[model samples]
Target chain A: MAGEASSGTFLQGLERGLAVIRAFSAQAPSLTLSEVARDVGLTPATARRILLTLEQLGYVRTDGRQFSLTPRVLALGWAYLSSLDLGELAGPYMEELSAATRESCSIATLDLPDIVYVARVPTSRIMTVALGVGARLPAYPTSMGRVLLAGLSSSELDVYLANMQTEQLTPRTVTSASLLRAAVDQARADGYALVDQELELGLRSLAAPIYNSRGRVVAALNVSAHASRSTPESLCEEVLPHVLCAADHITTALKHRGHL
Target chain B: MAGEASSGTFLQGLERGLAVIRAFSAQAPSLTLSEVARDVGLTPATARRILLTLEQLGYVRTDGRQFSLTPRVLALGWAYLSSLDLGELAGPYMEELSAATRESCSIATLDLPDIVYVARVPTSRIMTVALGVGARLPAYPTSMGRVLLAGLSSSELDVYLANMQTEQLTPRTVTSASLLRAAVDQARADGYALVDQELELGLRSLAAPIYNSRGRVVAALNVSAHASRSTPESLCEEVLPHVLCAADHITTALKHRGHL
Candidate 1:
């Protein structure tokens, strides 16, 4: 409905078009006209018009009946990624963290109520999900999520808590807003966050916030280790140092370059 | 101009908004409203409204004058990548190819006249550019580009050759359309493409095309190596076999799963 809102300054057609794109996910990659309209809360006629525009723009393709996106849509994301020097700066640090911990390392930033991965250095892991850049996870169950949540201002945190829904992904996952707030506060105090089997049953991760030159947390860095190989305490003791060291170095480099 | 065209079915606002997004590239990532209007050929007032809409949608952020994109825009690309089973199917094969060749392996698809990287398996190298998924390179000077170009139908190839400009990145680069067509034809006949120091000074690459269940070429796979480490002949002899095997295996897998 937010996208459907039209004002003098807000382009409803553009918003609805983007909504239609977002309506397609991994589970529902292709959709018929009515399906797209229903998913994005647009009329079939409007959806058809937007789809036609997208197809003309080379961002989408339709096989007569079902409409889907094309790889050219990636240029949109690249515009954002290439604009920032964060990913380029963080790539080496992420690689070093992955090397030191012998595990996967990733950097993510907060967006709305979820944290979106901006950069990653992956290891061949058995239990980890195959994820790449632009992958999203909820903000209350993961270590980076907590660090990012702690970075938010009180008003922003209030909006997030008001809008987000919490589910128990694992038994260790915190579901209540108060508990989530407490965890965020703890992360803020410690300058790091650790989650043990909160996202997955056998996964433990430790994360530290990466501050920009302005002392704002622009992103969070995390080392994800399998529980069979390391516990939260061990992760804190062994991997946290590397994570913090990388965080500090990244911050110093960003400050020197004024990258953020 | 194409986006600004409005028909009964084509939504002008939608195309214009997407054009605004595409106007920002790696070189001019952050642009002023006037610059964006000039780049996309829109009025200043129209660009402002579209930028306002994008900013409201959390895709673009403006620091008073210069407007830049946000990571939330990745969902547009994610919609396309998630819709395709290509990445998940090709990830392991790419990893194997990278491991076997001790070089970088990547899978890319033809989008318009460019090759957009969909998935990549990287090796830590000294001279290679730090590229990730969603990176684009012109489809006239590289191995994957030649393979993808070869995959296009005759009429499709005609449109591409007519529209795309060839640039001489290096002295070895073929700038003539006839030469490019010859290379593409050679790639098609050989079932692979190899380019030696055409795109870069000391880089060599070998590529193979992957087809779908219906025998349509969908993506191209390639192995990138350094000239100091491997020659074009060596790339063909040592790395090309692995690339073809992986390409064949990926095609078979996609066929079995009807994944394309």
Candidate 2:
């Protein structure tokens, strides 16, 4: 169920093997052969074959009887790091923004209805939130992703709205497509987005988009904090300016590097 | 050439696919078909085939015919995040340490001769070092890894030392085995490690191991800053105590969770 079914013989073995590797993460960095089998929904025999395969390839290592991930797994993340023009160019500006506000800040891109964090600087980690690099949150609910989506073409927005499977993450989560669209429109007009206890309870965030030289938003940058620390009004009044400034700085950096 | 020769019979195709995926990063999130091929030293046709396969697998997406990574890539790192009991358990403590020192902090596990960062709370990216959640650094040179290595058994340390290929990242890098072994021994005796201008010229870091209830060091924690900001004296005097305190707090948390 995790992968698309390809017509004819299109690397089923490779797909299964890759799924096994992907099965290991910060959450499940080590597993017994059977745990991996259940996680990837493959048979135990198949999982063992894949794990053995991965071990032989040096992407994984076994300790006596227990299995653990190897540092070689990092090569996958490094590939994306080595090739992304936006993430690299945004570094100095992200640091500047983090320094300017002394708050946790991040850059994320919209992966359709979800926002995947591509970069982050954690000034603090709220006990309830797991907001780290490579973390994901629903796009319709997160400030950064919504801001990025605000720049989408109307048709693209419509597609997202149509396909969105809304689940109320918290009391503030807007499950109605119309409400979400209105929020996106407001974000476009104001050039920023604010989410107040929508994605997670007691978390508030403000975001602004980083535009390429082509004027298309390639990413979004934001500052996030506890709702107790960031009232909606104060965020809009105090933090919004800094978020917008950071976005502009990132935009300028991107343009200077011709990444637009 | 980067992999063991016998690996081809195992998950080599998946490894190559991961290599293709790893080729993209915050620095290079997107790559032309030919550029990816060139960077990975794969034939253009082979790279194209792999990219097509990755696209089908939802790992990569095309933004107007140019290949860009999707949030799905985070799934790989997420596996590590979700699997590692140590990282999740260490989160709150890391944040506290980051706040206390007002500097970046991270936890790493020794991956033989290298250390792979498992959990981190980066305060800022002032020096343009864009290390991410799954980043790798030389174990002998990084404070966290050295601290972790200091806790290793003699045989384990011998194997690690025997296999180390110390590339001089900076002029200050420790290349001699005896010097590196002495540093490890000192760390074992003092219960902390200090690294200055070794990995990055301006960076200074201090680390301490986090022991579980079993009194075994499972991970290493460190606080890093610019040399101008945290001199060797300041790091040992000011930073080491705080790092050790945070490490103890994290160990208690891990014990409470019954993960120790």
**How do the residues A122-150 of candidate 1 rate in per-residue lDDT, one tens digit apiece?**
77622122467788888789999999999
Candidate 2's residue-wise lDDT over A1-260, tens digit each?
A: 11322334244555777688777755555678889889878877667767887787777788645677665666665455445545667777777777777788888877676887777766634422366566678898899978988989999999999999999999989889999999999999999989898989999999999888889987899998888777899888888888888789888887887743
lDDT of 1: 0.83
**What TM-score is obtained by chain A of candidate 1?**
0.92
Q: Show the lowest summed lDDT stretch of 10 residues, model 1 chain A.
A: A122-131
Positional deviation of residue A258's Cα in model 1 after best superposition, in angstroms: 2.5
lDDT, candidate 1, B1-260, per-residue tens: 22222456766678778888877765676899999999998878888888998998998888899888877888787767778757787877777788888888888999867899888777762112246778899889989999999988999988888777878899999888888899999999999999999999998889999998988888999998889998777777788889999999999998997645
DockQ of each: 0.49, 0.35
Q: Which residue pairs in candidate 1 have backbone atoms (N, alpha carbon, C) closer than 3 angstroms, thus clashing?
A: none
Lowest-lDDT window of 10 residues in candidate 2 chain B?
B1-10
Fraction of true contacts reproduced, model 1? 0.58
Strongest candidate by DockQ: 1
